[model samples]
Target: MTVRIVVDRDKCQGYGQCVFEADDLFGLDESDTCVAAAEVGEDRRADAERAADVCPMQAITVE
Candidate 1:
């Protein structure tokens, strides 16, 4: 199954914590903003969840 991902740009602080927690499902470009994968595989779900939890601004969401 595919997972939905969302990153709240307003809440994001460019910390890159989410990227470190879930590189396969989240990342930061040169601009240092949180980016989410449109569709993440099941194997990456756990990491994605962790990313969401670790985000200081709670900028990431998975559905």
Candidate 2:
């Protein structure tokens, strides 16, 4: 199944932790906001989950 990722921009601090944890699904933009690095796939679900886990702001949700 295709994964859905939601990042709460207001709660995010742009720390980039999610980017490192899930490079295939997360990134930091020029504005330092979190961005989707790529469309999420089943194989990348774990990475997405890890990103959610490590997000200090608790701003990421995956479904």
TM-score of each: 0.86, 0.87
TM match of model 2 to true structure: 0.87
Model 1: how far residue 58 lies from native, Å: 0.3
Candidate 1 global Cα RMSD? 1.2
Among these predictions, the greatest TM-score belongs to 2
lDDT for position 28 in model 2: 83
* Model 1 ranges off by over 4 Å: none
Clashes of each: 0, 0
* Reference-based lDDT, each prediction: 0.84, 0.85
Pull out the clashing pairs in model 1.
Answer: none
Worst 10 residues of 1 by lDDT: 21-30
lDDT of 1 by residue, 4-55 (tens): 8889988899998888877777878778887788887877778888899999
Residues 1-63 of candidate 2 have per-residue lDDT tens digits of 788899988899999999888676787878999987445778888888899999999999888
